[model samples]
Target: MTEQLLSIHELTKSIGSIMPVKGISFELKRGGCTALLGPNGAGKTTTLRMLAGLIPPTRGEIRYGSGDGHTDSWRHRIGYLPQYPKFYSWMSGMEYLSFSAKLSGLSGKEALRRSREVIEMVGLQQAAKRRISGYSGGMKQRLGIAQALVHEPELIMLDEPVSALDPIGRREVMDLLDRLRGEVTVLFSTHVLHDAEEICDDMILMVDGEIAEKGALSELRTKYRQPVLSIDVEPGEREVAWLDSLANRPYVQEIELGKRGAKLMVTDMGVARAALIQELADAEIQLLRFEAGTSTLEDMFMKVVGS
Candidate 1:
């Protein structure tokens, strides 16, 4: 079994009348990448803030290391980057990283050494001497990641790290994160399911301040996998009537219809596929496209969040 790096139990946070996190519990394995996934207003940021020690939880326990005991000393073993990080515009990337390293408790010389090392690790060495104000959005985010790594913490927590980047910027950060896997324990939050799917091994899905689903990504995919069929036909009286009749079919569990097509949730793919093709052939329907497949993580995400 893998070693456990962090364990949270019944962690709750309340701000007067609003409770952003409600008794959430999960564990992170050492050297594993986990995604705290949820839609907006789902308490992902609040949970991360509490774990980062930026705010006090109203109740529950946070434990680090292999021991059952809890302590505040784990702060030094972890680094955090918020969703929206602010930097000193006048400072160069190297200057900013060195300053941050010193603040994290390294000597001046060591700070400079680590700063240069991390800047290079993040692929910002070319722009290390450039003022932060002139850096593009992707560059700034990479710099932010560099600061988080300057102290060489065993674990790093990033809140919505790529949520605001353009396609190119998002790709850059995602690639950087992919490279960081196994080098350090990572826990990042994001609402974009594809981003989470692209990199994370484990997932803790939050909904309205509660964990709607939590498990290994592959396991969740297996547990929630369902048969689905997509059918598109040239719009006409016959096609429209045949499409409308599908919802009542015993093999179809559910359906979503469009002007030219219908997406079907089926009980069995083989039966549904054979039956649909035959129906189209018999009806002489003008079929444009037909596809059969299993549901994906996005399907489960929508089911959990929509509920």
Candidate 2:
């Protein structure tokens, strides 16, 4: 079995009376990627910062290396990148990585060598000598990641690494993260669940100030997925009324109404399908479209977050 690299217990953080993170707990296995997923103001950034040791926890314990206190060396084995990483505008990408490596206690020669390697790893080789001020948004983000990885830390924590990038840039960073999987333990925070789904094996879903769900992505999907029925009818008063009335049916567990459509979460797809078909026939409703499928990760996310 793979070892648990980090074990956090009831971690809490409050700033002056506003508690962003309220007693959240989870574990990260070695060489696994876990997404700290949440909506805006879900305390994801605060949690990541606490894990990276940037801020002291207001309460609870974070254990590393068999939960022992013998050595603080675990500090040296972790890398972190904030939501918006600022760099020395005058410094080139290569210079900054080397500088960061040296700050993390590497020898000058080792720092230079590692810096070059990481720059290439993050596709920053061509822009290695480019000044930070001249780099694009995506380039700067990648450069930030390069610096974080220069020392080859065992665990890397990133906060919304792709949140600010364009679609192409987001795709690029996500691909890099996919490559990083299983190479090192990663605990990155993201509001975009699809991004997490694309790269992570596990996820800790947060809402408000606490975790609403945490598990392997596949397991969570299986647990939350249910029979979903989508119905479309032409714009008409009777059509909307009939669609809305389906929500009150016992077999129809939940309903989301659209302009000319309704998505229903059914308790039993087979029974619900029979009843709905009978009703449509009786009313002679003009059914434009009907699709029955399983719920998705995004549906589960909205349900848990209640937003």
Candidate 3:
């Protein structure tokens, strides 16, 4: 059996009149990459902050380590990067990391060694000596990650690491995260399902401060996979009526109608596809696009968050 790295039980946080996190519970396995997924205002940041020991939970327990033994000094065993990381702009990348390492309790000599090692690990070796003010958004984010890793903690928690990056910067950070997998236990929070799907093996989805779903990514995908059909036709009176009429079909379990198209959750892809193609041919409708496939993680994400 895999070792349990962390176990959180009924964790709740309340600030005055509002409760952002409401008794959430979950566990992380050693060396696993797990994503904490939810939309904005879903308490993901608050939950992560609580886990990182930056804020005290209003109630509940957080246990760290394998077996029956747990530690209150779990802070040193985990590293955290906030959603918005602050930096001393005057400091060089190397200086920043070394400072962070030392603050995490490393000696000066060891801090310098770890800083150099992690700067290279995050592909910031070329910018190591350059002032942080000159670093690009991606570079700064990478620097944030490096500082999180400088102490070689058993676990690292990142809060929406790529939410602010441009396409190029997002790709850079994503690739770095992919490389870091299996080397450390990662628990990162993000609203984007695509990012979570790309790198995480497990996921815990929070909606309005509660765990709506939690499981291995593959298992969740398999559980939620369902036949779906998308159809688009050139707009005309007949085409518009026909698209709307798809909801009345017995095979279509659910339908979302648009001006030029409809997305259908169908009971049987084969029956639905054949029937739709035949109807289009018979009516001489100008087809723009038609697709038949299983629903994706995004579909599942929308369903959970929308509810």
Model 3 / residue 202 / CA error / Å: 1.6
TM-scores for all candidates?
0.87, 0.90, 0.86
What is the Å distance of residue 187 in model 2 from its true position? Answer: 1.5
Report every candidate's CA lDDT: 0.93, 0.88, 0.93
Candidate 1, 136: how far from true, in Å? Answer: 1.1
Which candidate leads in TM-score? 2
How many steric overlaps does candidate 3 have?
Answer: 0
In the range 105-197, model 3's lDDT, one tens digit per residue, is 999999999999999999999999999999999999999999999999999999999999999999999999999999999999999989999
Where is model 1 poorest over a 10-residue stretch in terms of lDDT? 68-77
Over 4 Å off in model 2, which ranges? 69-72, 232-248, 257-261, 283-288
- lDDT by residue (tens digit), candidate 1, 1-307: 9999999999999999999999999999999999999999999999999998999999999999788645467777889999999999999999999999999999999999999899999999999999999998888999999999999998999999999999989999999999999999999999988888999999999999999999999999888788999999998999999999999999999898999999999999999999889999999999999999888888878877877
* Segments of candidate 1 deviating more than 4 angstroms: 69-71, 231-250, 257-262, 274-291
What does candidate 2's lDDT look like per residue over 1-307, in tens digits?
8798888889999999799999988889999999999988999988888878788899988888566632155778888999989899899999999999999999999999999899999898998888899988778888888888888998999999999998888888888888888888888888888888998999999998898999999998888889999999998999988987877899988899999999999999999889888999999899999889999888888777776
